[model samples]
Target: FQVKKKQFFRNFMTITLFGAVGTMMSFFTISLAAIAIFSRMNIGTLDVSDFLAIGAIFSATDSVCTLQVLNQDETPFLYSLVFGEGVVNDATSVVLFNALQNFDPNQIDAIVILKFLGNFCYLFVSSTFLGVFTGLLSAYVIKKLYIGRHSTDREVALVMLMAYLSYMLAELLDLSGILTVFFCGIVMSHYTWHNVTESSRVTTKHAFATLSFIAETFLFLYVGMDALDIEKWKFAS
Candidate 1:
C-alpha cells in the first residue's frame, strides 16, 4: 500500500512538472510562427494576450485520451507516464491562467512569492492526500457492493456516476477535481463490477474516446476555416 502510494505521488510529480515545460516549448514555437506568418510582423510587436487564450484552450493534453489508450491490456509505463504528465500540465495551465487574470504580475514580488509558493504547497498536498483517502474509502464500499450484477448496463451507470459525481464534489470543495477522478479510477479498477452489457469496459472507454476525437476534429476544422477567411479579409483590406 505504501509503495503504491509513493509510486502514485512520484508518477504525478514527474509527469506534471516535465509535461508543462514541454507544452510551453511547443506553444512558444507555434505562437511565434502564428505572429510571423499571420500578422506579417515581427514577434517583438505581438501582444501576449492574443496567443494566450488559444494556449489556455489547448494547453492541457486530455487525460481521458491518454488513459483511454493505457487502460488497454497491453499498454506500457511510458504511456502512463506521458498521460500523467499531460494531465498535470493541463491543471497547472488552468490554475496559472486563473492566477494571471486575478492578480498583477508586478505584485508577484517577494512577499507575494511566499504566498504563491505557500498556496501551491497547500493545494498539492491537501488535494493529493485527501483525494486518495476519499478514493480508498469509496473503493471499500464499492467492492462490498453487490449491486445486482443482473444488468451490466446498470453496472456501467454506477461507474459513470462514481467517476463524474466524485469529480464534481471534489471541485465544490476547492480541491483538484481531476486528481480526485483519477484516484477514483484507480480505486474502481481494483474492484469487481458487472460486465458492461453493450461491451467490455475497455470498449466503452475507447468508444467515448473516439467520439471525443471526432468532435474535436470537426470543431477545430470549422473554427480554422472561419479564422483563415477573416485573416485573408484583413490582409486584403
Candidate 2:
C-alpha cells in the first residue's frame, strides 16, 4: 500500500537480480536434483527434460501469499524483496519456460547454454522495454488530452484501458504480457497517476487495491481446491 517508502523500494535492484539470475540457477539445480532423486527412486519414467519442465513451473513465485502474510509494518526489506522478486521471477520463468519447451536432450551442450542465456537476456530486455514504452505512451496521451480534467469515471476507464491494452498488445506481439503489465503499472504509478484527475487518483488507488485482493484471494482458493481434488490426485502419480 505504501509505495512511497524509500527504504523498501531500495531493495528493488537486489530483488531483480535474485529473480532473474537466482531463478535460472534454481531451475537448473532443481531439475538436476529432481532427476537424480527420481532416477534413484525408480519413479515413473520422467527424464531430465521432464524435470526441467516441472522445475520451470515451480520457478515462478507469486508475491500475493507473502504480502498477505507480511504486513507493511513488518520488515520492509523482506517485504520489498519478496514483492520485487515475485515480479521479476514471473517474467524470468515465463521466458525460461518458453525457451526450454522444445528443448532437445541431445543438444544440451556449452553452446546451448550460452545461447539460452543470450536469448533469455534479449527476451527480458525487449519485454521490459515494451512495458515501459506502453506506459509512457499512455501517460503521454492522458497528459496531452487533459484526461485528468475529464470526469473521474472516464479517467478511471482510460487508465484501466491503457493498462490492459498494454498487456494485450505485448501478448499479441508474442512478448511477455506479465512483464509488460508489471512495467506498465510501474509507469502508470510514476507518470500516469499524477496526470489523472485528482478525484480519480484516490478512486484508482482503492480500485487497484481491491482488485488485487480479490484476484489474490480467488487464486489461492483455486490452488487450495485443486490440491484437495481427489480425482486429480491420480494424475500426479
Candidate 3:
C-alpha cells in the first residue's frame, strides 16, 4: 500500500531479478555449501533434502528495519526497490520452500524439477489472483453499497475483514498468505481507500498500524524467547 504503483512498475524487473532469481541462487549456493561442509564433519548424515530445506529457510530476507529508517518521500525509487524486493523475496522463498517440501532427493530427474517449478508457479499465481480479486471486490462493495454513508465504523470494519478474509482464504487454499495480504493491501489502498469516508480512512489506517506494531513486537519477543531456550540448545549440542 505504501508503494507507489508507478515506482513499482518501473522497478518491477529489478525487483523480480533480485527477489526470485537471487533467492533461488542463494538457496542453491547455501545448500551446496552446507552439504559439502557437513560431509567432511562428524555430524550425523544429513540428506540433500535436509540441506535444501535449511537453504530455503534462510533464503528469505526481511528489510523492515531498513525500511523503517528510510524516508519513502525522500527516496521513493530506493524505497520501492527495497520494499518490492522484500515482499517478492519473502513470497518466493515461501513458495520455494513449499515446493521443496515435496521434492525427492532420490528422484532427481527433469520431470521432478519441472513439477517443483510448476507447483511454485501455481501457488504464486493463484495466491496473487485471489488477493487481487478479494481487493477489487472490497472496493466494489464500498463504492456501490453506501456503507460509508451510514457509518464509518462499518466501512472500516468491512475493510479490515476483507483483508483478513483474503489472507485466510489463501491459507485455506494452501497458498501464500503473505503474498495474498500484501497484494490485497496494495489493491485496497489504490481502490478501496478512495471509496471510503475520511473518518473510515483515518480509523482503518491507525488500526492497521497499531495491529502491525503489536504483531511485530510479539514476533520478535517469541523469537527471542525461543532463542533463549537453554534446554533446546542443550539437546541440539
Q: Which has the greatest lDDT? A: 3
lDDT of 2 by residue, 99-182 (tens): 676566668898888887777777678888988998898789888875445689888888899999988988787778899888
State TM-scores per candidate. 0.58, 0.89, 0.93
The local lDDT score (0 to 100) that residue 118 gets in candidate 2 is 77
Worst 10 residues of 3 by lDDT: 142-151
Instruction: Give lDDT tens digits, candidate 3, residues 201-228.
Output: 8888888888888998899899999999
Question: Whole-model Cα lDDT per candidate?
Answer: 0.57, 0.81, 0.89
Which candidate model has the greater TM-score, 2 or 3? 3
Q: lDDT of candidate 1 vs native?
A: 0.57
Model 1, which residues run further than 4 Å from truth?
A: 1-17, 20-78, 129-134, 146-150, 191-237
lDDT for each residue of candidate 1 in 75-169, tens digit (9 for 90 to 100): 44556576667666765555444433433334557887577546655555665665566656555544466772445565556666666766777
Minimal lDDT window, size 10, model 1: 1-10
User: Clashing residue pairs, candidate 3?
Assistant: none
